[model samples]
Target chain A: MRRILPWLTPLVLGALFLASGQQEVIIKVMGGAQKPALAVPDFRGGGDAAQHTGVFNETLYTDLDESGLFTMVAKSMFPLAVPQRPEDFRAPLPPPPRRKDAQPQRQGPWLTDWSAPPANASHLAFGYLAVQNEQLVLFGWLFDVTQQDVSNAQLFGKRYFGPLSADGARKVAHEFASDIIVQFGGAPLTASKIYFISDRTGFKEVWSMNPDGSEQKQLTNYRSICTTPAVSADGTRLAFTTYARVNPMIFIHSLETGRRLPFYNQVASMNATPAFTPDGRQVLYASTASGYAQIYIANADGSGVRRLSNVRAIEVEPKVSPKGGEVVFVSGRSGPQQIYKMNLDGANVERLTTGEGEASNPAWHPSGEVIAFAWTRGFEPGNWNLFLMDVASRRVDQLTHGAGRNENPSWAPDGRHLAFSSNRSGSSQIWTMLADGTKLRRLTSQGRNEKPVWGK
Target chain B: MLTKKYVAALLLSFAILFAAGCKKKAPAPPPPPPPPPAEAPAPKPNPPMITLFAAEPGTIERGQSSTLKWAVEGADDITIEPGIGRVSANGSRQVFPSSTTTYTLIARGPGGEARRTATVNVTAPPPPPPPPAPKATFEERLAREVQDAFFDYDKSNIRDDARATLTRNADALKAIFRDFPDRSVSVEGHCDERGSAEYNLGLGDRRATSAKEFLVQLGVPADKLRTISYGKERPQCTESNESCWQRNRRAHFAPGQ
Candidate 1:
C-alpha cells in the first residue's frame, strides 16, 4: 500500500521550494517501502533524431528504475495513447470495448488506461522533445493518475536543454529524472561519482565514473600501483595510496586543481587506506611506522599526525564514520582480522564482528547506523563476501553470497546503494548493488577494477 | 786306502787291522767331543698386538660426548689412563669431556706391552648470541632475513610458528652477512588471492614488515634489508585452498639489487 502526502499545505511546499528552488512540490510515498509504479512513455519529438529520442527514453527509464525509489512500468504495458502535456491527460476513462477478446485501445482516457488494469500505474511521466537551432529542448511532466482533475493530478512541469545529440539527450534525460526523483524523496544520483582502482592503463590508478557507470574518466595517471581511493565528501580532494616513489604512501590529489597536493611523508613504512573525514579536513589511514600496521589520523595535508591504535597487530582499512566522531577499521588484534570501531580520539575500542570469520574493508553507511564489510565467514579459502552490521543492535546481515570474492564496499550518498569490487563475473570488476543486495550491476569490464568508493 | 794296502798281505793284515782300529778310534774321539757339548734352549711367549685404540669421534663441542674404542690381543691386562682404567680386550666407552684431553691405553702381556692414545677435542662454547644490533634502523629489519614469513588468511601479523622459522632465518642471515658483508636482502611481501587486490597489497606490505621487524629483533642488521610488496600479483600457488593460499601469503626473501 502507498500513501501520497500531496495534501501538504502549499504554503509549506512554497516555503521549501522558495528556500531550495530545486523542485516545485514534493510528492512523498509514506509508510512502508512500497514504491509507486510509474509509467514513462516515449517522448514525442519533431526532430530528425529518432536515435536521440530513443536514447532519451531509455536513459530516463533506466535512471528512474535504478534509483530504487520507484517501480517502473514497462513500455509494453503502457496505453496506446501517451500524454505529452498536462492538457493531454483525460479523466473518467472509457469502458473497455465489449468483445470476447478485448485489448487496451486508444479510445479510452489516458489516465484510465494507466491507473486501471494492465499498466496499473499510479504515476505517469511523459515528455516532448524538439530540435531548435541545433539544441535539444525537452519538456517533461509527471502526473498522479489517481486524481481526476488535470491540475490536481499534475505534479510538476520542467524544461531541459542540451545539444541535439544522443549524449545531450542522455544528459537531458538524467536531469529530468533527477527532478522527478527529487519529488519522490530521493537524492539526485546524477551528482554522485564512484572512484575506483583500475588497471586498464597497465597500472592500478584511481579512476572515477558517474553513479550509473557513465562518463568514466581516469583521475590519476601515476604509472604505478595505486589503490584504496577515498574521495572527500565534498568531492574535491581524493586520497589514495600509491607506490609512485617505490613506497606505498598516502597521496592527496586535488580534483579541483588537477594536481597532487602536498602530503607528509613518514619515510620508511607503507601508508595505505586513507579515508577523509566527513568534513574533509583530516584523513585516517593505517601505517607501519610503529613496526606494525596501526590506525593513524592526520591533517588533510598530512601534517600533525597522531596515532589512533597501538596494538601489535595488523590494523588497516580505516574508514571514518559518516558522523565524524568514530572510525571503523579492520584489525588483526583478535587473532583474525575483524572490524573494529573506536572513538575519534582512539578511545573506546570495540570489536564489531563476533564468532568465526575474518572481516576487512569496513564501510560505514551514510547514516552511520550500519557498516558494510567483507568477511570470510569461515567458508575457507578465497570466499570473502560482503556483509552489513547494524551499529546499534549488532545484527548482521549477509549482503552478498558466495560468488567469488566480493570486497571493498562503499556506500552511496543516499545510503540505500553500494559500490564494491567482485570477481563473480571473473577478473575482479567494479559492481554496484542496492543496499539490500538487489539490482547488482557491473560498472567496469575493461581490465581489472577494484576498491570502488562512491563519492558524493 | 790303508785298509786296501793292509789286505795285500795276510802277514801285514795284523798291521792293517791295527791301522783301521786307529782310524775308528779317531772317529770315536769326535763323537766323544759332541757328547760333551750337548745343551737345551729356553722358550718365548707372544707379545700383545694392541690391535685397536682410539676415540670413535676425535672432536666434539663442549657438553657433547665421544666414544673410546679399544681392541687388544694376547694381553693379560689393559689399562687406559686419564679417566679410564682396566678394560676388556675389545670394548668401547662413551666419554664426556669439559675440555680437550687425550686418553692413553697400555696393554701388558707376557712378552711385552703396547700403548695407544686417543684424543677427544672438546670445542669451546660459542659466546652468547649478541642481542639485536642496536644500530640497525627499523627499515633495515624488513630486508635482512633469508626465510619467508607466512600469515593467516587475510592477516599480515606474524604467526607463532612463523616466529620460529624467522628465528632460524635470522641466524642464517647473520651467517650470510658475515660472508657478504656488503650484500643486502629484499623482503618481498605477497598475498593470496583471497583478498582484494588493493587491500592485499597493504596486507602484503604489513606481512613483510612484520617479518622484517621480527628478524631485526633477532639481531639481523636493518640496514642490510629492504622491503617490497607484490600483493597478490606474485602468487606462489594458484590453487584455491588453504595450503595454496598459505603458500601465497608469505614474505619471501630475495637478493637485493
Candidate 2:
C-alpha cells in the first residue's frame, strides 16, 4: 500500500486540476485482509547497473536478525569474498567442519572448553552491501552447515530503497539486513522494530524504533502504563496490555495507523499480551473467564470468539506458528511452567517439553522444523537460556552457554536464527544467533530491548 | 446574416474582456469581518449525550425489530450504527438481535459516540433451556465450540448452538471490567491443542479471547476480562493424540473476586 503518504511535492493551487488527475481513486477493498498487489506487470526493464539503497536497510536486517530468523554473519565476518565478486554473483562458501573435535584443533577437548554447537548452530548466514552507481544493493545467503554448499541459497533477497541522506544511511542499511530474510525467507521478520516501555519519560507508552535502534517512535508515549507488546503475525499491529484508565485491557493497535481498538477491558480482571493467529485473523490470549487463568481466541476485528482450553493453572507466554494451525503456550500445570502445543481450532492436544524448569516464551524457528524456547537450566536455578528441539526427533539442543537470564526468544522470518534480550552485558540488549545457537551478535546496545518480534 | 451577428457578439465580448484585463488589479487587503470575538466564550464545554440510536437488524424479527438510538446534545448530523453496515442521519437503525447477529452501534457527529455491542441471539423458538446442557466430553465439546466461532470467521458472528451456549454463559455474568471496589480475574488461554505446541499455544489465546468477549456483551465489565495467552501451555487431555487436542482448544473461565 506504499502506506508512506507522499510528503513531498508542492500543492500548486493552479495545479489542483493536475493533482486531481493523479488523485488515486482507491476503492479500499476488503478492509485489512487482502489488498491487491500494485499488480506491477512483469515489465522486464532490467534494473540498470545502478544499485538501489536506502537508509533503512541495515535497520531492517538488524531488526530481522534480532527476530531470531537469520544467523547473520556481519560484513566484518565475511572473507571479503562476497563483495569482491558482486558482479559475478557466484562465490564459493567456506567448507564444512569434519566434526567438533575432528577439525584441526585440540583433540578430545574438555566438556567445558567446548560447549555444544552454539545454540546448536546447524546453519550460517552471510550479508554484504554493494554500491553500484546511483543505487545501493545488499546481498545475503544462508547455508546448512552439515550439507555445506549443498544447501541451496535460502536467501538471495535484496531491498531497493528510495533516496538516502547521511543520517538515513545507517538506518537504511539495517532495514536491508533485517528484510532480506522476509523477502527471500518468505515469512514475517520481527527485528526491524523496537518495543519498549519508557517510564523514564514520565509516561509508560510502548515505544519502537528501527532495528539500527534509531528513529525512536512512540506507540503510546503516555502515562498509561503500557507493557508486554506482542506483535501480530505481519508486524503492522501490536497487541499489548495497558492500564489507561486504571483498568488493564488488551488493545489491538495498528502501528502504521496509530489506531487503538480496545476489547475485553474494564473487566474486574485484566487482559494483556495478545499473540495473534498465523493468518492474522484472530488473537489468542489468557483471561479470567471462569475466574482462573484460561486460554481464549477471537477474530482479528474482535468478534465471534470462543474458548479453546480450560485449566486451573496460570498459563501465559503463547507463541503461535505462522500457519495459525498450532500453538505453544506456557502453563504451570505441573507445579512449574511447561510448554505445550495444540491445533488452531484447539484440538489434537499434545505435550512437547516437560519436567524442564519453567519453560516460557517458546518461539518457532522460521523453517517450522524446530522450536526455540526460553528455559531455565536444569542444574542452574536462575540462569535462563534459549533452547531448541527438533519437532520430529524430539531431541532437545541448548543454544546459550552463557548465563544472564536470556528470555523472550522471537524467531526471525528465515527460521535460521532468533533474537532475545540478554542482561549478560549488565543491561537489556537485543541479541541474535544462529538456529543452532552459534555466532551470537549483539544488535541493540541501548535502553532495555525486550520482547523482540521479527517483522515482515 | 447569422455569421455577422455572431462575429459582432464575439467582438463585443472580446472588447469587454480586453477592457477588464486592462483595468488595474488591487493588492488583496485585510479589511475583513468582525474583530476576533473579544472573549471567545471559552469553547462551550462538551456535553454528554447519546451520540447514536438504532436497531441492529435492518429488518424486523418475527416478533421483534432491531432499534438503534443515540443523541449527542448541541450537534447536527447524527446516525445509527450500521445494523450490519452504515447508517445515515437518524437516531434509529433496525435489527433483529436474537435471530441475527452483527449488533454494534455508534453515533458520530462532533462528540464521540458511546459504544454498545450485542450479537443477535436469534432463537428458533427459545431452545429448550439447553435441557441440562450436560457437559459434553471435553474434546468433543471444544471441537464443536471452536467450529462455531470458525464459521463467523468465514461470514458473520455467533449463531445457533454457539449462541445458545454463549447466552447461557451470559446469564451467569457480572461486571468484569470495573477497576475499584473490584477484583481482577485471569483467563487461561488455550487452543485446540493440536499440531505443533507452539501453534496451539497461540490458538488457545485466541480461543480464550473469543469466550471472553461473549462474556463481556452478556454484561461483564471490560475491566474484568484479564487475558493472558497460553499458546498450548497446558492441557486437560494428558494423552497425546487427536482426541486430546480437540479437548484442549477452549477458554476456561475461572471466576474469582
Candidate 3:
C-alpha cells in the first residue's frame, strides 16, 4: 500500500489535470494524499533589479497561493539557507556519534530544517532574479524536500528572460509559476481573463481584466449601454448586447483584430444576452423578433438565424453546453423563470430547476457536468445568490450566502473557479472566487460592474 | 317796305358794326379762375394701432408656457382676454395654458377701439390624463380606462386586485377592438428591483402572460393583445419600499405599432 500510495497521488493529480482540459503536459509527481506543502522564498540578488525582483516574488507568491492546490509555508518559518540554485541546495552532514560537552554547532540550515518543525514543507520553490545584458533574468527551481536522496529532491529547473521592468518581472514570475504548477499536475490561472460590463466611464462598456483584477481595460467605447459580454471558446472574439442603435442588438468584436465584426441585426425591439457555442462556429442569443423574447441560434457571423425555443414565454440567457449539443437557458414557460435544458434543435426541453423564486444566468463548467446560476430561493426571499446544480442528478448546492445580490457566475477555464458580480462590498462590482465559494476577491471597484464571463 | 328796308340796312350796318366792335373788344380778360378745390378736413389722430401683436411661440405642448407679446400705440387702455385682464401698451406676459386658447387684445382710446387676436396651439395632453373629457381619443381612453395588473414579489399568478384590474382592462380592450379591429395592444410586464435583472425579465414575462390570458378568458380577443417584458429595466418607481415595489410590479399596456 505504501508503494502504491506514492504512485497513486501523481496518478490522481494527473487525472484531475487532464480532466480539466488544460494544455497537455509531460511532467508528473509522486506524493501523498495531503496537499503538498510548498515554501516560496523571496528570490536572491538585488541591486537595480531589487524592484523587479520584488514584483516577481510578490506575483509568484500570489499566483501559487490562489491556486488552492498548495499549502504555502509561512516566510517566518523558512530556513536560513534559502537556495538560489541547484549548487546552493546541499545535503546536511550526519551528527557527531557522541556529543560529549560539544556545543550545538551554528551552521547553515539544511533540508531537515524545512522538512521538520514549523517549516514542515514537503516541497520548496526558490529562485534568483538579476539584470543581465540589460534584461531581467530569472532562474526558478522546485524541489521535493521530503526525498531522502539529495539528488532526487530536485523536481525541475527553468530559466526565463524579459525586459528589466515590473511588467517584465511579472511576466517572468507568471511563467515560472505556471511551470511549477504544471509540474505539480494542475492548471495555471495566470492566463485566464474575466470579461464584464462597467459603467465607470459614465457609460456601460465592455471591459476585461485579469482574473486577479489587474490591468482592467475597456474593450468597447459604444458610449451606450452595453452588457452581457461573452467571449468565444477560443478567446479570439467577444459577443455582447449594445444599445448603440435605438434598439438593443448583438455585436461581435474580434479581440485579435480589435475591430467590429458583421452581425445581422435581428428585426426586434431588443436583442440581448448573447452566448457562444463551444465550437465557436455558432452564436446563441435571445431576441424579440417574433414579438416575444425567444432563444435564437445563428452562425458566428450572424447568418442563418434560427429560433431554438418555441414556447410563448421569455427564453433568455441561452448558454450552450460545453460539449456543444445541448443548451441550458432560463425560461418562463412554467410561470416563473426556471433553468431548462434542451437539445440544439429545440427538442427535449427538460426543466432543470423547480420550486420558489427564479433561476437565471446559467453558466456551464468546462467539464459539462455542472451548471452555476443565480437563484432567489425561498429561504433568501428577495435576495439573489449563486448556486451549482449537477446536470445529471439535479442535485443542487448553494455557493453563496445571502449577503447582497450575488449573481452572474462565470466559470473559469480551469473549472475550479468562478467570476461573478456582487453588491456585498456596497456597490456592484466584479468578484471572483473558488468554485467551492472560498477566496472571494473583488475584481472591479470603479463604478458598477456586472455580468462577468471568464474565459481562456 | 322801302323805309323799313332803309332803316333795316342802317340797323344791319349798325349790327355789323357792333359785331365787329364785339370781336374787337377781344378777349376782354378771361373770367377769374375758379377758386382751387377746397381741402378735405384734417384726418383724426392715429387710432389704436398695433404694430406687433403675437405669441412668441404660437404652438406649445400641453402644460408648457408661452409668452404673449403686444405693442400698441395711440390708445389709453390695452387689455388681453382669456386670462389676462389688462396689460401695458407695449409689453409681454408668460402664459401657462392647460389647452389651446386664443388671446384677444382690445385697445380703447379717444380715437377708436382696435382688437387683435393671437392663438396658442397646444399639442397632445400630458401623460397623466385629467378627468376624462369628451374629446379623448380611443388610445387615450384605453390608457386611462385600463388599469395595469399588479403582481406579488417573484410571483406571476394573478392576484385578487389584479384579477379585478384585468377584468376592467378586458372590457376596455373589447371596446377598443370593436372600434378599431386592426389595432393591437402590447402588454408590457415590469418587475421591482428585488430580483436579478435577467430573471426579472422572465418573471415579468409571466406576469404579462397572466394578464393576457385572463383578458382572453374575459372575452377579449387574444389576437389583439401581445406581450413583452421590460423586467426591472423600466420601473415605475425607484424608491426601495413596499409601496414603490408594488407600483413597479405591473402589466402595463401600450399601443402596438
| DockQ per candidate | 0.19, 0.02, 0.17
* Candidate 3 per-residue C-alpha lDDT over A120-211 given as tens digits, one digit per residue, 9 for 90 to 100: 99999887888889888888888888987658888888889988899999999999988988887778878888889998999889998998
Q: Which stretches of candidate 1 lie over 4 Å from their true place?
A: A1-31, A91-108, B1-183, B195-206, B213-219, B237-239, B255-257
Best by lDDT: 3
C-alpha DockQ for predicted model 2: 0.02
Off by over 4 Å in 3: A1-33, A97-107, A290-292, B1-189, B202-229, B234-239, B251-257
- Scored against the true structure, residue A186 in model 2 reaches a CA lDDT of 40
Each model's lDDT comes to: 0.81, 0.53, 0.83
List the candidate 2 regions with Cα displacement exceeding 4 Å: A1-191, A194-203, A266-268, B1-257
Could you list the CA RMSD of all candidates, in the order they appear? 22.5, 41.8, 19.2
Candidates by TM-score, descending order: 1, 3, 2
Classify candidate 3 by CAPRI docking class. incorrect
Each prediction's TM-score versus the true structure: 0.70, 0.44, 0.67
Best by DockQ: 1
Worst 10 residues of 2 chain B by lDDT: B147-156
